[model samples]
Target: MPVPPPLRQRILITGASAGLGREMARAWAARGRDLALCARRPDALERLRDELLAATPSAVVSLHVVDVADHEAVDAAVDDAAAALGGLDRVVVNAGVAGGDSLGLDGAEANRTTARTNFLGAVHQAESALRVFRPAGAGHLVFISSMSALRGMGGAMNVYSATKAGVSALAEGLRSDLVGTGIAVTAVHPGYVRTEMASHFPRMLMASDPDRATRAIVAAVEREPARAYVPALPWAALAWPMRLMPLGLYRRVAG
Candidate 1:
């Protein structure tokens, strides 16, 4: 059952320059929430903050130039954003890179970058958010894992898949750690959202528009579930059965 979500929240979203992160900022701002936007692209963040402020006069929009891969920087950014927003009620760890070639193709550097950005970067964000939430005893942490996390993927997806699985694990582990605590966490597994992340792919299964995907994700995040498959539909129904598929068949189907 879905419970009533906190309205007019103070949200800090990493990677708010484009794609799902950008759309989520818009969705939250439309609801008149305070936003702390962070991304490597400072110019883009400023534009988005301006747009949000223009659209909703009452919305409190702030920008933080951040690179999530830098642990110390991420920690500082989260603290700064929390202070700017008067304490964060929710933090969305949404920054990630889909860059990586096949492990077989000697793509070690690419694989390393992917792992660093996705897993280590997320660790910094989650830790920082928990610091804010622990004292508040009432906060939500949202991680944007992927449906690819259901199983290990090969080709260029090898590193990406493993990193997402780690992210999901973090959410699951946090659920156990926060038992009896008021803080909440959710891992959102979205299937092929039509953002820059999936734009290069030639064939995408159950592809979803960015706006539509953001709305669904925001809804699930607000509900504060331990885990959720976004744009539920076919994705939610298929999650379990897909996980049960044999590796050989999954590789073929995935490719």
Candidate 2:
């Protein structure tokens, strides 16, 4: 039988204090993988670290409080975390926030924040992870892009969609550049995941739980697929039509 991939390898995840990031940390910890978790909230990180350590005493888990949007802080955090883990086998850049209220006031600031965190922050994490992976010669880089990246969703999600689209492009381009380097890049496009991010949206649109989304993400990373559309069928199907729809119709439908 072929040897299975080792789940004991060191894995680093950002935004692991809550939502999909937290769930991914839990899922990986259950598999006995050593984890280095980062998020803005130290208390939440410490709580999760304690919980995971209590439940899985054999797993090595360390939590760091750092915002991905802070380039210098992320640089230092990633370096220290990788050192603590001896080396990183996988880095999941999951720290992100939805663009500000697209429909109401504060839209401008929200869009700006969205761009800063979603696009620039992702770039920072990817660059930092590559710095580590390039020297090591092998690693996995998992980017948590959204299905919103597939098409421009006008009205409330315009900036959010643009940011995700940018990151998706970044992931694809990096995958091409990393060819034959033994490093794998996986872009995850998840649709309507049930999390605080979707709380403001209509309930009918939500499809999968955070745990379910995390499972798909972890599976995609393990398989080292070029791209993954979570909750597969319907979300994947929506991608093409969204891209081809007339601008007027797309706006009406998305709005």
Candidate 2 lDDT for residue 169: 98
TM-score of each model, in listed order: 0.95, 0.93
Model 1, span 98-147: residue lDDT tens: 87777867778888988999999999999989998998898989999999
- Backbone clash pairs for candidate 2 read none
Query: What are the Cα lDDT values of the candidates?
Result: 0.90, 0.86
Query: RMSD, each candidate, Å?
Result: 3.2, 2.3
